[model samples]
Target: MLYKLWRSFIKEIFLLKRDIGGIVIIFVMPLLLIITITLIQDSTFRNLEGAKIPIIFIDNDHSEVSQNIKKELEGSKTFRLLTNFNEKTAQDAVFSGEYQMAIVIPENLTKDLNANVDSKVQTIVSSFGLEADSAQAQKKAPKAKELHLYFDPATNAGFKSSVMNSVNKMVFEIENKKIYKAFQEQLGTTEDIEENKNLISFKEITPLKGEKEIIPNSVQHNVPAWTLFAIFFIVVPLSINLVKEKSQGTSVRARISPTPYFVHILGKTFTYLIICIIQFLLMVAVGVFLFPYFNLPAFDVSGNMLSLIVVTLFAGLAAIGFGILLGTLAETQEQSAPFGATSVVVLAAIGGIWVPVFLMPEFMQHIAGFSPMNWGLNAYYDIILRHSSISQVSKELFLLFLFYIAMVAISIFYERKQNAV
Candidate 1:
């Protein structure tokens, strides 16, 4: 039985080696995807980190308070201050896509603040020129001393929120200082104000178990995700080969001989398992070695190496088991090829291979938990991102093994029923 399985495995390996396209699809395509996606993501993150939010500042108030606010904005690295313009010019610049936002400090801001009256500033945003006709047609617009904010409708929501938060913080500080000064004037004491200067503070906390580290970049994510995607793709070729053998009466020929049906299945599974492991190692090698050469982040594994190996082995088994099931169910090469290819794509989509599971809706997230790709991704993340120990990934390992077992059992049951008939 062992000799028969070995021979069958060797035959599959030889057959695969002769097929150039299959080899390229299994090996080269995944590396290309990982590199391409990682580079794009890295560039985007770098741009975001270095980007400065541009804002046009029109300080019509021109008072001590307004000047101070202008100086503060200019000093902030988060904002690029464009101060050489009035309200109309600033509004036009924003409309022409020259800036993302605009701010106007209303006249009598200092007087209103000093008198303890509610004060407002005017902010004008471009609105991406959506209502340009209506805005231009208005012959006379009422002048109000209120904070008028104008924003480009096409601007990213997160970027807009960040700019708003920073501006609001500055406004809060300015108002709080005015109130504090008023209190000092009424009470005739600066000692109380100085004593309560630090009434609020903030601290950051990490939810992971290990020492907090910088979050892994796109290379880390793409390498593992595309690696698993490539592994699952092995089903297509495996199914096609199995369908060809059945159509050619190879299975019948083997059954008439001394070789058992289980040996044939085991042989094919082992061959693909070897291929999966090789594909995974190659992808990881690209991350660790090739990525750093191009100045991208390297794949640094801080967790137990043994744990990574264990998880990877089970992941391979699960993928191979799935391929075997596809092979057993497929009647013809044409039927099996599309089913195998499309099923892997669907699995990758729902399993968080293409997108992070957290980004999915709550219901989709719940469904993703049932996907083998989800288990594989979680296992990889545990080892690579979380730096977890062997014990930490025991549950993922167990679930992966259970999935592999279930797939193999289903495949065998179907094969036996066909044989009995």
Candidate 2:
């Protein structure tokens, strides 16, 4: 009986053999997506590197201090000075992509600083307002005050970070001069205290720790997220095959034959399982060969063998089982396709696939815990990033095992009901 069932399953694989071209397309999709997104991300990185970060100066003061501030920036490597001081010209330059930001040293900037008074620096980046992504654009306004040091907001952390280092150094130099002068006068020494009088120097100012590393290859993030999505989408083709077999009366014929109904269903499951395995292998191969980012290591903290086996087994089981359950529940291609696609997208978005959970709201982060993406990602992190063993992921592995069991149970029940009539 087992031999017959195995033969039947092998027969089914060839019976509804998928179009070679279609299989090729499906297998290639993930790799193509990886390549395209990686290119875009790399291009953005390149554009940000050598391309000039242009800033327009609007100095309303026309004073020595304001001019000095302008020179200080133009002399530094942080920005290129675009010669558009007026608001209209600078705004136009920004909108036209000729400049990234504008620095407005408001009227009487020097007078305010020298007098120990408060003043505001007006920084403008494209009229579209601040791109939360561009630290350079958001910082031009604050860099305006680095020349005088006292009036800067110090609120924008990046701007404050760089400014603070310069300010610390300047303060130390000033204090050293004062100390040297006092000592020289007291000792009646003729030594010069003009240039080299350096006092307490800032060794290093560490920026805030745990700043999220920017993903250089966006595909590293996108590919895994979208692959999960495509796996969900595979349910459409699977379900359509089921319904098609039923409509053509082949399923009824199989039921009446020596093959048990369960064996017939097993055949269908095998078909999809083979396809999925092939899809996985092809995607991984392409990622490793073409993309240079495939085969993210499995987490393994302790040297335990059994735990690692369990984690991989349960994860694969859950993913495949979910695909099967979704296929069984769907009645038609049109109905299944959209649902499958949308479900993947929604689940990925919620699961911290697109944007990491840390960036999401507190409530959303909690909600993401329920998604398979979260479980999958956590498992991946444990294996790939954390180097954890399967036993270390007992909670996640168990949850996936349970999910697989539930899905299989539901599929069996549903198929039985449909066959009973």
Candidate 3:
């Protein structure tokens, strides 16, 4: 049995060496994708950190309070304010992806504040714009004295939240000043209000102890995501190989030998498992050495090395099992090629390889939990981001093992059924 297994493994290795296209797709393509994606994302993150968010400022009020608000925004490095922007033109620009957010200070803002009447600043988020009837559009448009903040739908939620928080703070300070001035006039005193002396204060509390900081960058995300994508993509070539063997009567020849069927299957699985490990190591090397060489963030594996290894083992097994299952079920290379390739791409997209699960819709996030790629990504993140130990990722590892077992069992059952027929 051991001899037969060894022979099968060696055969697979030689066959793979002959298949130049498969080797390039499985190894070279992933390296290129990871480098390109990481570079683009690193640049984007740097710009976001260094450059100010551009916003259109339409001050119809032109009052002292409105001017102060504008001054506050300008003083803070958070925003680059573009003034005297036409409302229609701004809205069009935002919708067309030229801008992220727009702020409109309404008319009579100061007058309403002086009278102690409640006034709303209109926020016209570009996301709110949609094709609608004239009456509906008119009804949805910003009313008088409303401060409208228009936001693009495609903008990152975290970025939008940060911008909103800053805007709200500015508005709060403006209101607080007006109220303080009113109180001073009523009390016949001209005392100035001190900074940061508001009635309410906010404090942030974090769960992490000590000064350990975990700042994950694009390298941390893309390396594991594209790795999983590449691993699963092996299904295409693997299925093709299996179909070719069956068409050439290799299966029948193997059955006639003294080796058990499980040995043959295990041999194939073992060969692919080794391939996956090598692929993973090559990708990790890129993250560790190549990224930092280009002035980009490198993979920070501050967690237990044992934990990373255990998760990676199970992830490779799960991916290999899936490939084997596809190989067994496929009747021909033509049928399996498209099915394997398309399924891997679709699963990767759904499993947060293409986008973070947090950024996905609520329904999609729920669906992502069931994906094998998501489980692998979660395990990797546990080690990379959380700096977790082996026990921390036990659940993810367990799920991956379960996926592997299920796929292998199904593939075996299908093979037996085909043999009987």
Q: Rank the candidates by TM-score, best first.
A: 3, 1, 2
lDDT of 1 by residue, 1-421 (tens): 7788899999899879877777887899889989988898898888767877778888878887788778888887667788898888888887778788898888877666654421111111123332223432332433434766667667778877887787778777877877666544444565665456666798765445457555667887888798889888888788777777789888789778887777887898789888988898898889888999888988876545567667778888888888888878899877888888899999999999988889889999999999888888898887777777778888888888898889889988998789885
Which candidate model has the greater lDDT, 1 or 2? 1
lDDT of 2 at 266: 62
Q: Candidate 2 — which residues are off by over 4 angstroms?
A: 20-22, 61-78, 91-100, 117-223, 254-271, 292-316
Candidate 3 on 362-417: residue-level lDDT in tens?
99999999999999999888777777777888899999999988998998888888
For each candidate, the alpha-carbon lDDT, in order, equals 0.78, 0.58, 0.80
Which is the leading candidate under TM-score?
3
List the candidates' TM-scores in order: 0.82, 0.66, 0.85
Candidates in descending lDDT order: 3, 1, 2
Candidate with top lDDT is: 3
Residue 189: error of model 2 in Å?
13
Per-residue lDDT value at 286 in model 2: 52
Which candidate, 2 or 3, has the higher lDDT? 3
The whole-model C-alpha lDDT of candidate 1 against the native structure comes to 0.78
The window of 10 residues in a row where model 3 has the poorest summed lDDT is 117-126
Per-residue error (Å), model 2, residue 310: 7.9
lDDT of 1 at 371: 88
